[model samples]
Target: MPAEPPVDPMTDRELRADARRNREQVLATAQRLFAAQGLGIPLDEIARRAGVGPGTVHRHFPTKQALYLAVAIDQIRRLVDEGEALAATDDPAALFTLLSRMMASGAENAAVKSALTAAEFDLRDAAPDAAAGLTHQVARLLDRARQAGVVRDDVTVDEVMAIVAGAFAAIRHAGADTSPERSAHLARIILDGLRPPSRR
Candidate 1:
């Protein structure tokens, strides 16, 4: 008897394209809502906003925590994708632009910040492999910027990460009345700090 081509369980149970799309939509909507609102949002509301059925949402994410972890993982994957796209440009300025954009967007995104700061969630545990990939992509971006003579050669990835973390912390503290200009100004300052020291 044929061994049936050694059926791959993972592949066999792969989600249909529609199901995948619905899942992505759910995650994106959830991230947006969670950022604007908080993690207290109901799954039904998320499904409603995503234009999907509650069962569809539950089928993809069995619980609120599962949904949260999925959202975090998706966010990390997006950063990884953006880093790869920018790295291909080999432009230090573009890298800075990406960093600035991240800081600006991070200002409004509580869910993303929570993934990094919340001890209860432990994103590392939720998506260890994706977490490692995000770190690698970020390091690559910094290395490229350093080699381009745009960013200070002495600056380590850890230092850049620290600066980014500080920016997010500031964003968290910012009042609702805070203007967008404030975030852009802070991003510019951070970018300036990363540049090589001026010659006399």
Candidate 2:
């Protein structure tokens, strides 16, 4: 009999699909657990919640810090995607709309807040590539709004980001008594201040 080609237990496509699913499951599980229990939660617990073995989790992320950084990187990447999408819009008010949406969502995003405030993970150093992309997208969006006369002509991207960071910080520190409506109202107030003198 002609020698049969070595039979692979799993095809390349199947292996890739399995890896993809495992990665997604790990991320989702980690995000949920971290948000509920804080970033101090262990990797094995995340693996348990993800229904994957500890080895599997390590195979994907290698370390808890790696997983945490991955989560933060993913969040930053998503913000960049959103910023890019809004930058493509013709609406003069799209920039503030994006800010409003971010503020609203920030109220519920504990994992991101933790990542931002964490001393252990310096996101700027750890994910410089992703951070720079996000910064560029945000600057592009602000420029679009400025050129449309929606935002102040003198407002720079760094200044705008500083304001946004403060606003998100406020939202993070706000008591449970503070409603989402109140958060939106506060965000709108900031947005109002960002508008051109003529628009105010």
Candidate 3:
């Protein structure tokens, strides 16, 4: 893989914090490596670049697929974080904001998503709690949007999720990976349907 920035060196810390920090470094490193070089990058290489012991990576992720799933789960967790932040805001269009963030995040990691699919690792199955939390956040914002007459009243959380999935597919179909501008445009076009007819 091409040389990227090295993971920050582990600092003097307690064991628990050290372990958490190390695992985070590994995930962040693995996510980047997989994104840059695909899933074929070696675990040892990931550990080397992450500035952690090889055993650390293997202990947390015994298989490449495990690491890939972890990366996907990490992405969802970040989205959930964004969703939570939006939930705290009084913005009436927060739902759209959250959805746009989700779409962009998905576009950014479309390669890992493809690898997960090839490995038959569905994130909902692999990390149900994280998946449910994100959906819950989306549903909360969506209810607020509907009440504010921003989103259509008929759309359910399931439909919202389906739309996200469809956005990923459309993004992939257009080969927008290298073009963030094109990806955002596609996301806007798809997510616009969630708005009430007049708003759209």
Candidate 4:
């Protein structure tokens, strides 16, 4: 029998890289679709928009619930990244920048979040590491802000979380999920409450 050709290590690495790219594209497309049209969008449609085969999406996310959770987790992980980047800065008010991003990110992915909530899924349970990392980042920033007297010393990381949750609720209650301007306005009002009282 003729000897089989040896597999190229570079080829395997290239294939893996291509798969990663495809997965990222699918995730981004599904996130945009779910945000714009809700979770009713078909997996096939997401693959189509992502320029990948249907099997690609199915291989990565077997069902709508899986996709929803992945999207939610991805959103949080990105926020954690942003928070980490902000923490490296000298700006004490970087806390506001990170919190602002968290608010905006949650609002943008509200539809996916609603679906996960309906399914009784919490990111803290589904993705413990990323969830805890996000909280830790927030805590670090909060501590720095407090030390700088930019934010109220009385506020704990837990309270900051509750306030963000409340802000999201308020935004949804006002039917402002589709309106970035309105959502931002509401978020500002709630975040403003975090500022320390004037010494004057």
Candidate 5:
């Protein structure tokens, strides 16, 4: 009998590219369905919408918590990216506008919002590498904004996360008709409080 060849693990670059495509497709479909219905939609439905099989979904996400974690992490990465992109704009209002828009859009996606909330409940620390990278990126943008006199020095990253968590709670309680405009308005109000007091 001939010996069977051992299967090899995917190369890092190939794995990353595959994961990126799968993640993007899952998020896009999940966002559309969740926005239309809510987070209560079945995982099977999400898989179907994404044109993937249930087994494939499970392979990517062993449980709802895993799926939620993936979504929350992706969202955080996106926000951090957007923040960094706007960090050098030299326009406080523009930066604020971009932040507000992101917050509003975030409020509408029930799956992503629920995932963020679940992440809070899980409270397991992020993996060291991911945590460090996200912290560095977010902190860099925040420090720049504070130095530019746009964001208040007293507003810590923890406080910003708290506000985001609260916003998700508000949306969940309010239901699908929850207005993104209202969430944006509320986020602006919260951000206003985080702004440094005017030097008299």
Candidate 6:
């Protein structure tokens, strides 16, 4: 039998460096394309924008679903980090307002908005780590608010999520008249429901 070719020894550092560059390029291109043309933009455009061949893009992403998953995971990680930073605020009202604004901005991003919708389909199966991290951060913030009597003890984290999701939906569903003031007003109403009962 013919001898099999010897396998080459892989350098972990080199492999990691290459993968890092590819991932960065893909993400940057995808962000720009999605921002300009929404989530329906073609993958070929993303490859061209990245200055990478379609084959290279496929080698990294394999499919549109994979690319969307990667983008969703990245956005979720960023949101978790932002949530952690916001969690440090002492004022609950300000914290909720900041979070609401962040959610509104995220809704404006076509890729993120799509991902948020897709997230409902398989939230447990897809991006579990990102989802868990976000959930933990949100729970922490809610707990802090509850302990301080700024947020209602009866409100669950799920309820807050629903409020944000509804706000995003409303903004998208309303064509030209979707003002930030309207979003803020709706957020205030939601927050009112989350407020703790007065000690008096």
Q: Judging by TM-score against the true structure, name the best candidate.
A: 4
TM-score of 1: 0.80
Candidate 1 local lDDT, residue 185:
76
Per-residue error at 163 for model 1, in Å?
1.6
Q: Which 10-residue window of candidate 4 scores lowest in summed lDDT?
A: 111-120
Question: Which 10 consecutive positions of candidate 5 have the poorest summed lDDT?
Answer: 115-124
User: Where does candidate 5 clash, by residue pair?
Assistant: none
Candidate 5, residue 107: the lDDT equals 81
Candidate 1 local lDDT, 1-200, one digit each (tens): 85668755555336476678898899989988987788789999999999999999999899998898787778767877887788788576666766775666566566555565554465667788876776677788887777778888898876776687687666546652145787777668767988888710
Candidate 2 residue 168 Cα shift, in angstroms, is 2.5
* Predicted candidate 2 versus true structure: per-residue lDDT over 22-91, tens digit per residue: 9999998887776667678999999999999999999989988789778767776777788778877777
Write the number of the candidate with greater TM-score, choosing between 3 and 5.
3
Q: Best to worst by TM-score, what's the order? A: 4, 3, 2, 1, 6, 5
Please state every model's RMSD to the true fold in angstroms: 5.5, 2.7, 8.7, 2.6, 5.0, 4.9
Clashes of each: 0, 0, 0, 0, 0, 1
Error of 4 at 148 (Å): 0.6
Per-residue lDDT tens digits of candidate 3, residues 21-48? 8999999998888767777899999999
Model 5 steric clash total? 0
Candidate models: Cα lDDT each: 0.75, 0.75, 0.82, 0.83, 0.64, 0.69
In candidate 6, list every pair of residues with a backbone clash. Answer: 152-194
Better of 2 and 4 by lDDT: 4
**Tens digits of per-residue lDDT for model 4, 1-200:** 99999977678789899999998998898889988888788999999999999999999999988988888888878888988999999999898888887777778885334422333477667888977898899999999999999998899998897777677778889998889899988888888899987821
Candidate 6 TM-score versus the reference: 0.77
Better of 2 and 3 by lDDT: 3
For lDDT, candidate 5 versus 6, the one ahead is 6
> Which has the greatest lDDT?
4
So what's the TM-score on candidate 2? Answer: 0.83
Instruction: Provide the TM-score for each candidate, comma-separated.
Output: 0.80, 0.83, 0.86, 0.90, 0.68, 0.77
